[model samples]
Target: MAKESSHAVHAAGAHRVVVIVDENSNPFELGCATEIFGLRRPETGRDLYDFRLCSPEPRTLMRDGFFTLTGVAGLEAADAADTLIVPNRPDTDVPRRPAVLDAVRRAHARGARLVGFCSGAFTLAEAGVLDGRRATAHWQWADSFRARFPSVHLESDVLFVDDGDILTAAGSTAALDLGLHMVRRDYGAEIANSVSRRLVFAAHRDGGQRQFVERPMPDLPDESLAPVLAWAQERLDSPLTVSDLAARAAVSPATLHRRFRAQLGTTPLTWLTGERLALACRLIERGESRFEVVARRSGIGTAANLRTLMRRETGISPSAYKARFGPQTNG
Candidate 1:
C-alpha cells in the first residue's frame, strides 16, 4: 500500500470505528482503514467516524519491519467501537494469539459490525464471525481461504461482499469501495459522493474485482474499454444499446459482449443501466425536487419507471429518498 497523505477537518459524529491489528499486519490495509474512516471530511462540514487502532497487545512491527506502530489502543477498545476492522494478515496460516481472536469474537457477539480487509478474512474465519456469512478476500488467497473455511460462502469474484454486519473486501484498495459504501449506508449518498470526490477516486465502479484477477490472455488483442465507457457516460441521457456500444468501440457486437463479460463481469446493458441509475440517485439527492426531470435527465425513460426502479432498488420511493437525503441547510 502506497502511503497517501490525508488532511483532517473538524471531528464530529458518534460512530466509533476500531481497527484490530496483529504481528503480521499489512500496512496498506491498515492505511485503508485510517484513510477512509479516520479522516475528518471538512467538505461535509463534519467528521464521520471516531476511528482508532486496537491491538491484543501494545505496539508491533508491520510487514517485516516496514514500519513500527506505537500507542495503539488494546482489545478493550473493541468493546466500545460500533465498527471493528481486521486488516490484512501477512500469511493465511500464521499463528494467531488467542486473545486477538477472542476480542474479535466478543466484539461481534456484542453487535459491533465486523469487517475484514484483504487477508483479514483469515482472522475473521478463525474468530468464527464469518461461519455462515457471505464473505470475500483477495483473489490470490481464495483457494486457501475456501479450503480453510468451508462454512463461508466465499465470493471470490467481487471487490467486496457486504452481508449486512459482516463485510469483507477483496484486496488492499478495494477497501476504499467498501468504505465508501459504509459511508453511503450510514450517512447518505451525498456524503459518500463528497468523500469520493475529495479523494479523486471513482465515484462509481462498473463491476467486480474479477477484472483484476489474473487469467490467461485471450487470443485476440484486447484494447482498453475505459474510453468507450467514458463516451457512453457523457451521453447517458440518450438511449444506449449493445449495438451502439459495439459501433463506438469499432468492434463486433459479439466481441463487445465478450469484452464486457471478461472485463466487467456484467453485460453492457446492465452496466449502462447501473450507471444511469447511479446518476439518477445523485441528481435526486442533489435536490432535483422532481422525479420527472430526474428521470429524463438520467435516461430512465419515464417518471413512473423511475419510481418503480427506485422502489425496487432501494425499497424507498423517490420522494421518500429525497426527503431523507436531499440537500441540508445549516441554521
Candidate 2:
C-alpha cells in the first residue's frame, strides 16, 4: 500500500471526516475515530477536520449491549465527508445491512477516502471496495478473511495498510496509529506530534511493525526464537549479518530465513532495520543532536547513510523529525 505524501499539506477546514456506526460495532474503535478526528485542537492553529458520526439507523446504536451511542447523524452525512471510517463489526460472517453497504459503496464511488478498523475491513470487502487491493484486519480473523475474500490481498502482518485512498488497520488498537498517519498526511509532522503529545503516545509507529498477533511472543522456551531475537536486538550496533543471526540461533541461514518468514512474516534484515530505526528514533527523542552520533549509536554506520535511510523510511529529514519528537518538545 502506498502512503499518502506528507509534503502536500491540505488546507485547513477542507477535510470532512465521518464515522459510520452500526449495531454490534465496537465502541473502542468508534472512540478511536472520534478522539483522533472529532476533537478540536486549538494547538494546531488551524482547523483539522470537520468531524461527525453517522449511522445507517440514526437514532441510537448499541455496541454489544455494553453502552449506547445517541445523536448520530444519518447515512446521508457520509456523502458530504472527505473520509469515511467503518469501525469493527461484531461478527465478520454476519452480513451488513444492505443500506449500510450501499452507503459505503456510494461514498467510495464519489471519491471519499475509506478506512476500516479491524474487522471493518470485512464490511469494505463486502461492499466490493477492497477487491484486488491490499488490506488487513484483526489477526484473529486472518484465515476466515482469506477464505471469504480470496481476491483481496490480506496482509495479516503489519499494523495497517495504506493503499492510497483505502486503508485497513490490523486491529482496533492499531486504529490510533492509522489515524495519526492520516493526520500527518493531511497536516504535517509538527501538528501530528502535537496531537500525539496530547494523547501520550508516539507520533508515529512504522506500519512495518505488523506481525501475527497470535504468536507475537514465543511460547516455547528452548525451541523459541525469542532468545535469538533478543540477542540480536541488544547488539544492533554491531555489523550483524544474516549468517551472524543464523549462527546465534544455531541454525543455517536458509533455516533461519524460513523461520523468520514463518513466524514474523518479514525477512530478518527488514526486521533488524526496523529495530535500528526504532533505536534511532529514541536517540532523536532523547535530544541527540549530532547526526554522526545518532548514526553510530543506532548502527546505521554513518551520518550520510542515516539521513538517506531515515528519509526513505520516514518521509522526513532527521532534523525535522527531532524538531517534532525531541525531548524539548516534551516540555
Candidate 3:
C-alpha cells in the first residue's frame, strides 16, 4: 500500500507539468494535456506552466499505433514535475512497465501531485499510489478498476475526482474538463476562463457531473442550452432562478432539468450558482474589495452569502481572494 501524503508536492519554481507517454497511450488525452498546459497563450502574454512531455522510451507509439512520438524528455523529467500526469493507455489489461511504475512511486513518495486520465487510473493504482485515495476513471472501466483495486475509492459516476494531490478524469473528453479545472486551481478563475474561451469550451463543469448520459445525443438540431445559458449569463446579476432559465429556454422546469442533465451533466441551480460565483470572483479580481458590492454586482445576494459560498467553493474568504487576485497596492 502507498503511504498517505499530508505534505505538499516537493516541487519548486514555475509550476512544471510533465506528461508521461507510454506505448498504446491515447492521443486525444495527450492533446488535451498539451492544449491546456503547454500551449503558448498570446492572449495572456505569458506561459502559464512549464509543460513537458516525457516517455520511458526514446520512441513511443501512441494508441492503435496512430503515430510515433519521439525526441521529448525521458522519464527522469517526471521527477522535476510539480504535477506529473501518469501514463494512460487504452490497453488496461497490459501491465505497465516496471520502470514506469517506479517513476510513479518515486514521484508520489516525494509528494508530487499525480493525475490519471481515463484508463490512467489503472496505472496509478498498479503503482500503489491510489490505494486509499478517491478517484474516477472511464465509466466503462469502473467495475474493473474497483475489482482490481478494492482499497481505492472509485467514484464511477463523476466526470473526475480532485482528491487534493491525486486527480483523475473519467473519460476522453472529461480530460479537458479536469485540465481546465487544474488551471483554475493553479492560476485562478480569470485565467481559466481565458483558456476555456480559447478552446471555445464551457468555462466550468463541476467534477461531480456524470461520466456518460444514457441519451447523450440531442433530440433535435435546434435543441441547445446556448441561448438560455447566454441569457442567464448576461443576467447573472439579476435575481435569476432555475425557473427563469427554463422560461428563457421556452421549456418546462422539468424539461430544463432533463436538458441540463443531458447536455451539461449538472442541475440548473448548480449551473446558475457557478456562473454567479464566477462573476463574483472576477469582480474581486478586478479590485472589488467590498464584499457587499461584489455580492450585489454578481447577484450573489449579500456579503454574508458571498462569504459562505466563496468559502464553500474556493476555500477562501472574499478578502483573501481579493488579496490573492486583486490589484497589488503598495503601502
Candidate 4:
C-alpha cells in the first residue's frame, strides 16, 4: 500500500508534531527535528512535542546508500497533526505529489502551523499555503523560488520568516534557528536557552545569512586584510574610517576599496556597518548594563544610531533584541 499509517503519541495534551521526510532527504534537517522535538527533555518541565515521521510513499527512504528509514506514517497523520514540518524537498524543480499537496492544504485549513525549511518552501508554495504570505528559502534557490511562486512575498535577505503560524527558514543551519525560535515561542526563552546550551550553539545569531555567505578569498601575500580586520575589531569603540583601515593595511584608499569589492562582494563601508552591528548584538546578548555603552563599543556612537542601524538590519530595536537574548537574573 502506498499509504502506511501510524499514530503520534500525544503526551497527555502535548502538541502533535508531524515531519514529512521524502527520498534523498538530508539528515541534518531530520536531526534538527529530532533534536528540537524528538529528544526527551524532562529537565525543562514543559510540554514536549510528539513527533511523527510521515511519507507520501510506502517504500523505505534511503540516504547515501546507508541509513534507511522505515515504517513512515501516512499522509493522513498530517491531517491530525498540530504542526506540520516540511524539510527540504528531494528536488526543488520536481512537482510535489497531488496527494501530498492535498494533505498539506487540509492541514493548513484545519489551523495547523505550517513550517518549511530550505527548499521545502516549494512544497508549501505548491500547496498554496504560502500564497500572499512572506517566506524565505536558501539563498541559492531564492531566485528560482520567487520565479515559481510569484504570488508569495519572498524575502531572500532574512534567515527566517515567521508569519504567525506559517514559518519558513533558510538553508541548513538556519533551520536550527527556526526550530529554536519555535521552542521559545511554545515553551519560553529559558527552555530555548537550555536547549541551545546543550547543543553548544550561540543562543542567537544577530543579522541574517548575508553575514555568512562565501566571498572570493582575499589575495594579498604580505598585505592581507586579515590583520587590518583584527586590528579594527579590537578597537571598535573608537571612531574608525575606511581611510584609517587603508592606512593600516598600507594600501591606497582606492586599492583598499577595490580589494573589499573583489574579496567581500561589498564596499568597506558596508562591511564596517555589518561588523559594528555584529558587535552590538554580541554585547546585547552578553547582558550589557547600558545601551549607550554597547553603542559606543560597537562604534554606533549614540543609542539613537544603534537603534536606527539595528532596526534597519533586523527590523527590531536594540532593546527588543536584548530582551530576547540578554542574560536572565533571578530575584
Candidate 5:
C-alpha cells in the first residue's frame, strides 16, 4: 500500500485501512494509525497500506474539544476497508455511536480485520464482536470493560492482544506497537524494520509484554546490551550462543537473561531465534529458492529446521510465503 496521502491515499494493490473517528475521540491514536498505515514511508520507499479516515458527522469535536475535525471521508468508508479501526476515545464511559457499532458489526460479519486502539476495545465489545475473543485495552479501563462485558476475555496488562483477525491495543504508545505489528504481518520483517527505523522506534515488542514496567530499568551505556545486540545481528550466520552474548556484554549468562526479561520482555534465545528467522524471511522474499541456502545463510542450521521454525513462527511454509510476497515473474 504505497500512496501519497493527504486525506485519502490511493494505491491499487495495497490493503485498504480505514479509521473511524467519532465525537470526543482521541486524535493521538488516530494519528498513530495514519503514521503507520496512511503515510508514505520513505524508509522502504513504499507505502504499506492504503489508508483513509472517516467520521460519523461533518465536524466532530475531538477529545475535550481539542480540535474539530472535518473534511474527511464519511462513515460509509468503513464498508470498503480490508481492515476497520473503531473510534478510539479517552472517555471510556461515553457511549459509542450506534452507527460506529453497526459498522463494526458489519465489518465483523464480512470477515474484515478489526482493530481497537486504547479504549476503542470498548467500542468493539459494545458492538458485540469481541465476545469470547482475547483482547486488551488501556489498563485503567480493564475493570470497567470486564464488568460491562463479562463474556469478553479482557487481558489488560499486555501491550496488545492478537486474536487472529481481531486485535486490540493497550494504550496510546501500544497503539504504535500494534500498528508496526500489523505492518509486519501484512508485509514482512524487512519492510517493518525499515518503517520502524524511519519512525526511530523499537522494531519489535512482543504483544505479550506488560503494559507497565515491573522492575527498575538499568541505565543504558553503563550496562547496555545495545552494543552486544548490534554485534550479534551483524553476525547472525555465526554459531553464537547465550554464553557468547553474555560474554560480549561483560555479564554472566544469568545476569544477561535477567536483563533481557526486564528490558526486552523476552529471553535471549527467543530474540536471537526471531532475528534469525527474520533473516531467513528476508532471504526468501528476495528470491532465495534453495531452502538449504536460506537456512545456512540465516544460521537456522538446516533446511528441515528452517521449515519447522518457519511454520511455527509464521504459520506458512517458505514456498507459500514466496508465492504470497515474493517478486512476480511473467511467463
Candidate 6:
C-alpha cells in the first residue's frame, strides 16, 4: 500500500481507466489501451471504461511525425484513475518526472492496478513500483532494463506477467494479450473473448515470446514435420506422442526432436501441449459448457486432467474460466 487517497474511483457503474501519454509516445501502445478500454462496445452489455488519455503537462503531444494529439488531461487524471496504464515511453534514459512517478506510486498504493506495456515497463520500474516484482518488457530492452533496475525480477521470455495488481507486458502485439487479460480479470473471460472476437483475434495465444523470436535457419530444410503437425492439429482429441509424430513425419524420433528444437525452439511435446491448451481456451471462449467435452476435444481426455493442466497454465480451474468466458446469458 503506497498512497491510496489520490486515485479516483469510477462512479457506481463506470470503470475509470487512464492512459499516460507523453511526447513521442508510441501510438500503437497508446492505441492498445484506447482500443480495448476506451472503445465503445454496446453489444456485450458491459459497462464501458471511462477512459482518459493524460499527460504531465497541458500541451500537444506529437507522435509518428504526422499525428498530433491535443487537449489531453494532466498527470492528476492518472492519480485519480482506478486503473492507470503507461504506454511506451520514447526514451528510457530520460528521467521520469517526479510528478508522474508520484501519481503512479499513489495509485498503486491505493489498490488501483498499474500496467506497463513495452517500454512503459521502464517507467514503472523507474517509479519503484516494479522493484522486487516480476515483470517483463520487449526482449531487446531486457539488458538495459536489468541494468537500470537491478532489483526488479524481470522475466523476458513470457508474453506478459500478471502478478495480481501490477502487470507488465512484452513488446508490441503482446499489449493486446495484456489488455485482454485485464478485461478477463476485471469483468470475466466472456467479456474478454467478446472483445477479442470483435478485434478478430485469438482469445488466447500459445506459448510466449519465445515462440515469436527469430532464430538462425536450420541446416536442414525439412518440410517433413509440417504434415504431421497439421494432422495432429486436426485430431487433438486423439492422444499423440513423440513416436507417433515422428512416425507420421517419416523421421526418426531423435531427428524429430532435433528438428523441433531447431525450428520451433521447443520440444515437439511442449508444442503439442501448448496447442492443446490453446484449443481448450478457444472452446471455453466459444461458450462450451461441458468440461469433459472441452477436455476431450483438447486431448486432455478427462475433466480431471483438463483441470490440472488449466490450473498449471493459468492458475484457474476450468469451471472458473468458463464462468469468466462463457455467455453472459443470465445477465
- Maximum-TM-score candidate: 3
What would the per-residue lDDT of candidate 2 be over residues 1-331, giving only the tens digit for each residue?
A: 4435332223454488998888889888888888888888988666678898988774555666877777879888988878889757767888898988898999887777899998999999999988889998888899999999999999987889888789889866688989988886565555777888988875666676654533545556655767888999899888888899999999999987877766666678887887787688677777789989988988898989888988887667889878766766545
Candidate ranking under lDDT, highest first, comes to 3, 5, 2, 1, 6, 4
- State how far residue 38 of model 2 sits from its true place (Å): 1.4
Residue 193 alpha-carbon offset, candidate 4, angstroms: 0.3
Model 1: runs farther than 4 Å from truth? 1-12, 206-222, 261-266, 303-320, 328-331
lDDT of 4 by residue, 171-281 (tens): 677788888877755544556677888887655443243423344465446645668878987888889999999999989999888777555445677777777876787
Model 1 steric clash pairs: none
Question: What are the lDDT figures for the candidates, one per model?
Answer: 0.78, 0.80, 0.86, 0.74, 0.84, 0.77
Native-to-model Cα distance after best TM-score fit, residue 24 in candidate 1, in Å = 1.1
Worst 10 residues of 2 by lDDT: 1-10
Q: After superposing candidate 2 on the true structure, give the runs of residues whose Cα lies further than 4 Å from its correct spot.
A: 1-12, 211-331
Residue 186's lDDT within candidate 3 is: 70
| Residue ranges of candidate 4 with Cα displaced over 4 Å | 1-12, 63-66, 206-211, 214-331
**Positional deviation of residue 282's Cα in model 4 after best superposition, in angstroms:** 17
TM-score for every candidate vs. truth? 0.84, 0.68, 0.92, 0.63, 0.89, 0.78
Q: How far is 122's C-alpha from truth in model 1 (Å)?
A: 1.7
Q: What is the lDDT of residue 239 in candidate 2?
A: 87
Residue range 1-331, candidate 5, lDDT tens digits: 1111111223456689999999998989988898888888755656568789999999989998899999999999999998899998878887888998999999988878899999999999999988888999998888999999999989988899887788899977899999988887777777888888878998888788778763546676667668899999999999989999999998999999988887777789988998899899888878888999999999899999998998877667888777655665201
Candidate 6 regions exceeding 4 Å error are 1-14, 42-48, 63-66, 184-194, 200-202, 215-233, 242-268, 278-290, 322-330
List, residue by residue over 1-331, the lDDT tens digit for candidate 1.
Answer: 1111111122355589899877868988888788889888888876678898987767787888887788989778888778889756767788578888888899877777888888888889998888888888988888998999999999888888767678788876688888887776666677888888887986755325452623234445545677899999999889888899999999998988778777666678878887888788888777798889999999898999999988765556888777666775211
Q: How far does residue 56 in candidate 2 sit from its true spot (Å)? A: 1.5
List the lowest-lDDT window of 10 residues for candidate 6.
Answer: 1-10
lDDT of 1 at 126: 90
Off by over 4 Å in 5: 1-12, 42-47, 214-217, 329-331
